[model samples]
Structures are given as C-alpha cells and as structure tokens.
Target: MAASAYSDHPELCVKDNFKQSNFKRRIQVQCDLLKEDQCSAFTAISHSDKAIILSFRGSEEDEVTMEVVDAITVLPVTEFSGKAKVNQYFYDAFNDLWNAGIKNDFLSLKNANPGYELWVTGHSLGAAMASLAATTLVTTKIFPADKIKLVTFGQPRVGDKTYAELIDSIIPYAYRVIHKNDLVANIPPQFLYGYHHHKSEVWYNNDMTKGQPYLECDEDESKKCSDSVIDLSIPDHSMYYNVTGSFASNGCKGWNVFTQ
Candidate 1:
C-alpha cells in the first residue's frame, strides 16, 4: 500500500502535461521563494476511491541550499499544541508554505472531498516536507490523526524521540521506506544530532533478486533500525519505484528515470 503511494509521484510532477485519469482534482503547488521560500508540492483527489494524495517534489535547485536547510538542528513543535520538537529548517520551510495558503487550500479540499482518506508522500527533501505536513495536519486538528496516512521514500529523521513518539501514536499508519545503501536515509546523524525517525520501517536490500524481500524493522526507537547504519551515497537515494540499472555507469540520474 505504501509503495504504491510512491509510484504516483512521477505522474504528479507532470503539471502542464498532466492528464486527469482517476484523479478528479489536481492542485499544483509551488510556493515562490519571495512569497514562501522554496516549497513545492501537489495535491490530487481520486473521487472513485475517495483518496486525497499530497505529493512533494524533491530538490530541483541548488544542492547547497538543501544542505543548509538540512543542517538547521532541532526546535520545538510550538507552532501547534504538540510538545515534540522537529528539524528547525524543515518546520520553517513547511510553515512558510502552509501559511502561504497551502493549509487553507488543503482544508478546503478536505471539506470539498468529505470522507476521502488522505495520503501524504514524497522523496528526498520532499519527503521531509511531507512528514512536516502530516504532522501539521494532525496537530492543527484539520483532520483526525488516524484519517491520514504517510509513506515516504528515502526520508531523513524529521524530529527527536518525543516527536517520533508523538507522530507514531497519532498518525496510525506511517511507513518510512529505505533502499539499501541509500545514504539519505541515514541523515541528521542520530548520535551527533539527537534526531530520530518514527516507528515502522520498510527496508529493501541492495541485491535485487527474484525472491528478495523487504524487511520490516523493529518499531522501537531504541532498536536504531537498519537506517541508523551509516551509508552516505546519493545514487541509492534516487533508485526507487522499480528503477533498475546502474545510475552512475549508465550516465543517468534518478530524476532522468522519472522524466524520461
């Protein structure tokens, strides 16, 4: 179920060229840097299934900017009623976009599509934003916690232990999927930064074989999980959604796979 959410991202990126299939409403979201910093995402509604998907795009600009944002340590979740703390940069970025009408837009969509199940997803930086968005949705009472589902690929640690506990308890179905050797998954070093991920992880091994299966790691934060192990490489981060072939050897990038 979670993996399928990721598969929808490629189509969501094709804004102008998008063809409305199962999705009845497609809202393109790109927060101008002057207005709300660099935040971009899209929300689509599937009336047939009563599902609302909020997908965020990965970094498409300067890598230096992304590194700077990722380094913004920790801050309290004071923006809402939660006692938990989150990555300052992620929260600030998400807050800026939310305040710029994304929140109201989402709420309006929710009201318009009553009874629709909300699913949030993204990759890389987008995944971090998605996590913050999910947290905000629950914290603000815009929607009941259980009514939302979050599934992110190559997601970094968004908050501290308390924040992890809070999200895990509230969101109900949060799945963080990591591919083997994907360095982005081991970001914001836990020991050095005191960051932690939410409970429940789905790990796919490096070796892709006919019978190879994804492992479900221990849900407890103390477990550390497979993602806790250090493996800093960007190629793995881009290899998801059944994409095969060596990215480096083929002179191709992950984004190329999606764009092509």
Candidate 2:
C-alpha cells in the first residue's frame, strides 16, 4: 500500500498494484489516496488480520515537504495529554491530511469493520506522520492506544521526551525499523532540537539483505543500534528489506519481501 501511493494515478498503484502484491487476497485498499501538502496515504482493510492498515507515502521531490523533513520547531499534541510536543511542520502536515478527509474515511471504515485494529506504517517523512497518527488516533478514542499497531521504517523523531514517553506507555507493539545508517532517522538532532524517539526500535545493522541479522534495541534510543553507525547515507532511506530504489522506480514491486 505504501508503494501504491507513489503511482501517477491512484488506481494504477492502489488497485492494480495490490492485485500483483503478496497480500492481494488478505488486504484491500478502501481509499485510494489522501493528500494535503504532499502528505499522501491510503487506507487498507486486512481480512486475515481484521485490521485497518494506514500507509503514508514517504517524502516527495518537492521543497514544501523537504522543509517539514527538516524537523525543526515544535507543536503541541493537543489530543494527547501532558506537555507533549512535536515537529510543527510534521504536525501540520498530518493534521492537514487527517482533517482534509482521512477522519471521515477512517471513521466510516472503522464503523463498518467494527472490532478491527489500526495498523500504521511508512518510511522517512511518512514515518513521522505515522507516529503522530498513532498517538492522535489513541487520544481521540479512535482506538485504544494499545490496540494500534505501528511499524515504520526509517522513522525520525516525532516529538519530545514526554511525547516519546507517551508512545512507550501507550503502545506496546510500536516498532521503529531503522535501516543501517539511515540519515533521515538522525535528523532534527536530539541534542540540538530536543526531539526524542519512542521506545521499541528494530535496527537493521547491515545492508538488510536476506539472511542478514537485525537488533531489537534494549533502549528506546539505543546508541548500540543504527545510532552507532560510523557513517550515514541518504540512499539508505529509500530501501527497506527487498524494496529498493525511489518510490516511482519501485512500481510497487518487491513489497512482498517486507510485508511478510
């Protein structure tokens, strides 16, 4: 579903793409696309898992999203309790997409599905939005925080220490999958801007080739994971598992490798 968001037309990626993917029979896209300020995502219903998968498209080749990717400044997570703060740009973009149409679409889907769980995933910029969505969805009573399952690749910091703590306390199944030396995962500088990552990090220390080992960090922001890398690379941000190249280049191929 994440790959589908990159297509020139929603049907090409959302419908046709899913037909060719591994989860074709198990999951189906209900909403082709949701967009506001280049923040794109889609809603998918999984019959086997009885869940709703909200997959956000990663960064675009535009300046507007690039600015938000900077991860500077902060905004309050109004739905979440306590003094939780997040990246102003990310929060706005998430809210923009959510308010534009995701709310109604999601609510309708949830009502139809009834007891379905919420699952969110993304990469790069989309990863940040996924985090915010997970938190907001919980605080708004859309889903019990514990029922929302989140697994994002190359996720960057979405909020401050308190917010990170909220995620740790709220969601037990959340996991941030950071490929070895993913530069995007290091942005917003923890020391400089005071942004912090949530708990449960799954760090791939190698090239993420088949048979390669990965570490489930013992710490929320474990230095022993990708943070220990001697060098970081931007290209690393684009590939996860067997999925490789830019979003357009993938053509929605190789998703089975990661989805499994």
User: Candidate 1, which ten residues in sequence have the lowest lDDT sum?
Assistant: 244-253
Query: How many residue pairs collide in each prediction?
Result: 0, 0
Per-model CA lDDT versus the true structure: 0.63, 0.69
- Regions of candidate 1 where Cα sits further than 4 Å from its true position: 1-37, 61-69, 72-79, 207-211, 218-225, 244-260
Residue-level error in angstroms, candidate 1, position 51: 0.6
TM-score, candidate number 1: 0.75
lDDT of 2 by residue, 104-211 (tens): 677777788788788887777778888988988877777877668898888878887888888887778898998888888887778855688887889887778778
What shift in Å separates residue 33 of candidate 1 from its native position after superposition? 6.9
The root-mean-square deviation over C-alpha atoms between each candidate and the true structure, in angstroms, is 6.0, 5.1
Q: Give the top-scoring candidate (lDDT).
A: 2
